[model samples]
Target chain A: MKTTRRTTILLALVLLALPLAAFAASPSDAGTRWLHVRVVDRSDDGESVRVNLPLDLIASILPEIDIEPHIKDGRVTLAPEQGVQLGDLRAVWAQLRQAADGEYVRVEAGDGNVVVRKAGTLLEIDVQDGPEGAEKVRVRAPLAVLDALFSAPEGEIDLAAAITALAEAGIEDLVQVEDGESSVRIWIDDRPEAP
Target chain B: MPRPRVTLAAVLVATLLLTAGGVVVLAAAEVWRAGTFVLSVRDEGPNGARVAVVVPGIVATLAAVAIPFMLPDEAAARIRPAAPAMRALASELAGLPDAVYVAVEAPGERVLIASRGGVLVIEVDDGPDHVRLAIPLHAARRVLRSVAFAAQRTR
Candidate 1:
């Protein structure tokens, strides 16, 4: 009787603690995150494609794949062909990070207009080009992700850290592009698939 | 066939009526339960092509059960990684309030994507063609969940 009672009590405690432990681990918006990329091509042959990848898998595999001199050691090194200097990028990023949350750059030209600003937790960028500025592109990412990109030394971008930030932030619609043909959206969430 | 039994014929008639009544009741119940599913589409077009689709919530939920069997091994493996994200998207959309997620108006074309009262709607009007789709967010989530489930079983 004692053994049976003891076993029953232990089982009950375990059952009770399971939910509490789970809640504590992921109280609200915290858990394994999945990155989602959706493209809807609405042209002559309309097609919708969805790609979902877990941040953990991406973080693990990114270092394994090498793209010559440009990407190595889970970090991205700029090539001479790219023309943009790492020092300039780092300087701009540092300035943007410290600056107050507001529109920093706004250019309205005859061809197009570009807007780049820091809003809340996101670095928002919008670019309009083409005829009458019809083609539009928007990119939004958490500050943490940007910080991770510059985490490495010698002006190399640390992709692993950036992925970790993307996983933790649970961001949605990190990048969106709209044109006459189709619209593309990429986001990160806790879900593995898209509907 | 042995005696041309009247009882058998009577039973057949009674069974048909009972089944028919049961189907009607179930359909009504489904319509009522389809809160996240059914929504009116206020779309304007020159052609005025209208279509009514009564997709029960259960149908979307049931797709989860069918995923494993319907998907091939290779496809299921590919989908396994994305199942969780599908569930997350579904959950977020289901809870989101009325808002326009995307709206683009171009020459001779207009596209609107919005969520209203837990229902996700997509509308596109191009030239004389107009298409609108409204789905309860929960149903979409359920369908996505099934995809996740199928992905797991494949592994």
Candidate 2:
């Protein structure tokens, strides 16, 4: 009778533990999945705008700002913690101000790409992938347009400082700044991975 | 001569009533649900919009009430064949009390399956080469999460 009771208890324990085990195993057992996003400039004008980024990279970076991200079927979904919206925006703006030293403009992200455009009345911004792997950013807007937008009282807008701040925020790496007569373009290449 | 103010007021009121009646008749012919979201689609143009609203649970209950009365006869016939399959699918989704309600629309014959939680998955009938997606409740939650994020960011 003791042995029968012991066997029944063991069976019940095993049944109880089964669900817990399954729950723990699901996420990792799903294996490695890749999410790719591509953006094309479908405008008639020769406005060169192209961006590519992996969704997993964004998912990993979201936690720094206290956002829980979930990716399913190539869509990156994020749920911000309650009351973190305004706080996050303020913190982000403050960080940008400090980094730019009053040379900050507008930053936008859409279709899985972060775009920093010429801060002008007209909408002019360069589209590029977020800092992950070897990605490149090409800004086709002219310097005059950008300069006109950046009407600073004291000094000119420092692109290097702005780019560095963006990189630190896990946005992108500014590799080379190309200056042209018509357009001053900056190429943001992905930073080399650490071993 | 005295101004015909009373006659004008009567004419205006009659016109307004006729317009309201016409709108009601047209609305009855279409599929509309006021739940966590408001979804209204016209049968003629197949043009529709879904907008999220506050008090989704109450809205969903109200939608449940209005669905039967509003569903046109043609839509009712089209929905009959897909009803069983939709019920089975809704039952498969956890946390849903009732089987998914199927609403059909003419002009290419579209099918909208809505759960008790105001989650809708639409299917379009395109001859033999057709595709239908059954989005789970979790997927709907994910969508809502994204919208919430957007709202936060905008704020």
Q: Candidate 2, residues B1-155: lDDT per residue as tens digits?
A: 22344444555565556556666754543233222433333223345333332344344444444555555666656554344333333333333322323343334444545443334454444333233443435334333333323323311
Q: DockQ numbers for every candidate?
A: 0.02, 0.01
Q: Please give each candidate's TM-score.
A: 0.47, 0.22
Off by over 4 Å in 2: A1-195, B1-3, B32-130, B133-155
**lDDT of candidate 1 over B24-140, digit per residue (tens):** 776775555455444434335554656556666677767756866898888887776555555555445444445555565556677777766557788787766767788877667
Which consecutive 10 residues in model 2 chain A have the weakest lDDT in total?
Answer: A29-38
Best by DockQ: 1
True contacts kept of each: 0.00, 0.00
Give the Cα-based TM-score of candidate 1 against the true structure: 0.47
True contacts kept of 2: 0.00
